[model samples]
Target: MSAATTAAGAATADEELRWLADGRRIEAIEAISVSAMARRLPALVVRAFRLGWRIDRGAVGLLLTCQAVSAVLGAAGLFATTGTISALFGPGRVEDKLAHAAPSILVIAAAAGARSLLGITIRTVTIHLSPRISRAAEAEVLRATVAAELTAYDHAGYNDELEAADRGAEVCVDIVGEAQNLLASLASLLGAAGVLTVLHPALLPLLVIAALPQGIASVHAARVQFLANRATIGDRRIMANLRWYIHVKRNADQVRSDTMGEFLLAKYDQVGRRLDASSRRAAMQSARVSVIGAAASGLGGAVVWAAMLWLVSTGRMSLPRGGAAVFALTAVGTSLRGIVGYGADLFRTGMYLDDWSSFLDTAGGHRLERGTETPGAPRRIAVENLGYAYPASDRKVLDGVNLHVERGEILALVGENGSGKTTLAKLLAGLYLPDAGTVRWDGRDTRDLDPHALWRQVAVAPQDYARWPLTCRENITLGQPTAEGDAAVLRAADASGAADVVARLRRGLSTLLAVEWMGGEELSGGQWQRLAIARAFHREAGLLVLDEPTAALDPRAEHRIFQNLRAVARERAVVLVTHRLTNVAVADRIVVLEDGKVLQEGTFAELVAEEGGRFRELWDLQNERTGVPARRTRQDQRTVPDQRTRKDQRTLPVREDEGSGR
Candidate 1:
């Protein structure tokens, strides 16, 4: 009793903590909290450096080379200036000759050309590598998401994952910038030191004292800025979502009818105000950091300039050389500033880099593997006592669930909300694993079978299907288990409803999608659902599990499509999940489910004929609700098997039955 009480207390505490962390606004505020910003700087910088080396290899090499050239160019520009001063003083005989203007022109031209070429080359290299790096990062993330178990996706908000993906897409740009700046800064700093060494080796110590403090302070400042940005992400996304709702056509009428414009604007203002506060804090922190940096620069420049003034007064740095020393001092200041700027950028990019790195490092989800062998058609599938719960759930969603599917028959699964109908369908489709039960194909554990092989024979149109913003031809081919060749896409599109869609599309199969960016127009919800079905049809798999396949379809369309599906199911086994009982009569057998357990199973005629059974209650309720006659005389209500005499186990949903079914 004591142990149980302790466990309950712990659970209560955990729930409270989770509730505290859950709100979009509250979570965003906490995420970007800057209290420990300084602590993460070193890690962030390190992560940015690693991404440069890993994803943008060519850009990174070019960055290093650019740094070297920039240093050389700085030295040359210094040399050219020195040559000018020498020409005035006749200190070097070469400078006296160059006083004729020809040599001076060549020196100026060389310095200008080197600087221009370095900038152009670095930009070109970074741009050239950006696409490849972006593609690789996106691919890695997609692969990870697909391979991971389904639970992760269910809990993560759509906006959160999308933002993460956007960050992944920008990883290349951040990587290139992080690397180029670091190299450029280092080069500039070294050139500054070299020029200062020539000016007066004694003053170098003061320069170091001034520059190093700012570099360290800049790193700390960057951390605070990143934290502030994080704190605003949640609230920012909410405002963005609100804006989307207001602007979208479907929601426009609803918004106006409900007078939601002011509500949305208020929500936006609330988030925006918090964001403004966070931004103000960040700006203040930045101002403080800047003031410190400026003070250090002023003190260092003053010491160097004062020393130069002293030398000039003492005839050490002559009038012309003293001017040169001042130029070098200015260059040193800019170089020190560059070093701090680069260090700060590198530090900030580190956080983005770590996310990108972790995302890319992930592999093995929903990826094509060599181990998958070609699977042939299965005669039967049996699920024996299959049970599962999600990763973070304490309650078992599917407890002692058992099911079976035979070749060439339709099975209808009926259940209340959250009764594990969809979960069972996913398990049967091999998209999920059974925690304690065995899923066998012809009595062999499916674990031994290759997943790719299994997928080739199965097609599942999920409860929530992806409406890819792609061409009509591409959409249907996605239904296929494998990537189809161009010719196959053409053929698949022809069979599905996509051919009609293609005709309407100005560019047909090549048309791009999205009003935000390209040539394609948005599809209607009903149209999108049809397109999704077409994708499944194109795949031509033997096993099909459809959850609310006609949920978005009009009644006439839904009725026709199911008729078409029954005709198409001639050579396949279909598992259908739906809330409506109208089509339940079409299945070979009906399985009644409630609270995640199968309450009873039988043909519609067999189950409905029984007194007060769950199926009878549901059936009676549906017919009564629709005012449909209980007795049926038409042949349209039943399915007859083909001439081949297997068992009368012929699966067609029956509205009224004489009790002759499997």
Candidate 2:
């Protein structure tokens, strides 16, 4: 209703757009928003009560005091009117009654004008500050999200938590703005109550009693909605996913390929139908709450109205007082109903703020602590009896697995697609911690080491590269910062063999990744993979772990990259996880994995020399698949075999004794 209230909702959509840019379900939003609101509630309430003081607290107080004085003057003017009527027939009224009444009426008019101006000025201030609140709240969401550990996102409830947090952040402005309006309404209700008290004190208690049931119902309705939001959070996400499947560009190919475009459409329709049904049910319940509350308030007003007419008939009250009494009761009754409605609105919004606060409370465990020591020398990363269970899974992916990498040496970790090679790499890089045993950096446990600090010295080309929507420049720069311009980016691009891809873009390095916003063409998977390799190269960390890094490249391009890797490895320990033995032939040492442990380790010559090892088996399979001979000679392996010695994987044991988290 006021300018201040209007401002809170105006810039909200833009603020939410910035939020949506993070991801489909923003993990950081809740910690940022609701937590701060919960902390600020007391202050907000205090501000609400003193809200009218914005133009000048003293000036507003002076204005209100004058209005009170003017109302008293108007009551005196009423007495003047009554006396002037009786005096027309006899000497019942005071002299100059009309002239005295005129000044009282004029003072009332002047006070009313001052109050209007104060209201407008206060409204303007509120409108101006609304964006500040929204942005501040939104900033908190971003801070908490980015600050959280990557692994915390593995949980399913986090998906719901994230959406709820955004909802809370979006609705918080409405809550506070409406709260201010509610307070103003409360003031009017107070004035109306005082007027009613003067007219008939007997009806005052009855009106309050009549309002209680509705007030309770309003609060109950708010709780119901909050619970519904909590319950349907899963359904809402499913609906969103289905809706995207049927409409979003990314899912279009799959939906059509299965020719279940209509089936996907039907699923979307089903989810939509359920959502509609739920919303309608909630609306009906809310309407019932409102209706019952309204009836009670109307009854209270009717009681007061009936009493006034009776009092007038009994010659105990004047007609003018009776009319004033009617206005007072009706206004007070409506205000009662409004107060209940506003209270419900506030209650629901309070939960949103609660959701925000609760999310923030969870931020500390996820973000890296600032004071952790950075590793002095990049050392061998060892997985000792390492075992992992997926979040909420009963079975282990990497059970009692032992693996080791020495400093400045390449270790080729090989396994079948689902045999946990990538998972082991993630554990080694500190993206994930083993459920049991240790992934130690030099003899120091990874849990004791700060992940952020470790990440500074480690670069990983994950199974999937993060395809940032920013320009190719921003995308690569995200892996590292400080350098800018096409020249710096081109160098990194060239190193990762992505320079040609960048050269083909319309704006080259400056072109945006997405086709929707900035006018730039998109790259294919192979091209994006090259960009990812450039990003990893740009990181320039002491430890480089590439998972299937050469999957998208041709044999010739792959060979060229392997040459680049040998030069890069002089300063850093390189771990290549790949199925292509032909590509891994360039590694300084090769570690072959079967199930989750190392089956054998040696130089390519030595491992190939062993007649019965897993490396030889894979080599033969690749040779057969590629139409090349991987024929091995016993004399070729003789001296190399003498140089290599290894241990069994069966001796590794599991351990999980540690504090959960602070």
TM-score of each: 0.75, 0.78
Worst 10 residues of 2 by lDDT: 16-25
Per-residue accuracy of model 2 over 579-634 as CA lDDT, tens digit each: 88887788888777666666677899998899988788878887776666677654
Residue 71 C-alpha lDDT in model 1: 75
Q: Specify the highest-TM-score model's number.
A: 2
Residue 624, model 2, lDDT: 70
| Model 2 / residue 568 / CA error / Å | 1.7
Off by over 4 Å in 2: 1-98, 198-200, 311-320, 364-371, 482-488, 625-662
Kindly list the per-residue Cα lDDT of model 1 for residues 1-662, writing each as its tens digit.
69999999987877211111225633443354233344554455455445556776666677667768777887777766665664665555665556654575577579768888898888877676656666766776766665554544544343354344456456556655655666666666676567668867866677766676676567657767766665565666777777899888668998999999998888778778877998999989988977887787678667767877898899876676676666677777777677567656755665655445544444312232323445566667788988888755888888887889887788999977888888888887677777788887777676666776777778777767886767666676763435546666655445434456666877776665565445467777776777777677667677888888888878876776677777656777789898887787788988888877889999878988988898788777777755756676446445555345447656465545455452
Model 2, TM vs. native: 0.78
TM-score of 1: 0.75
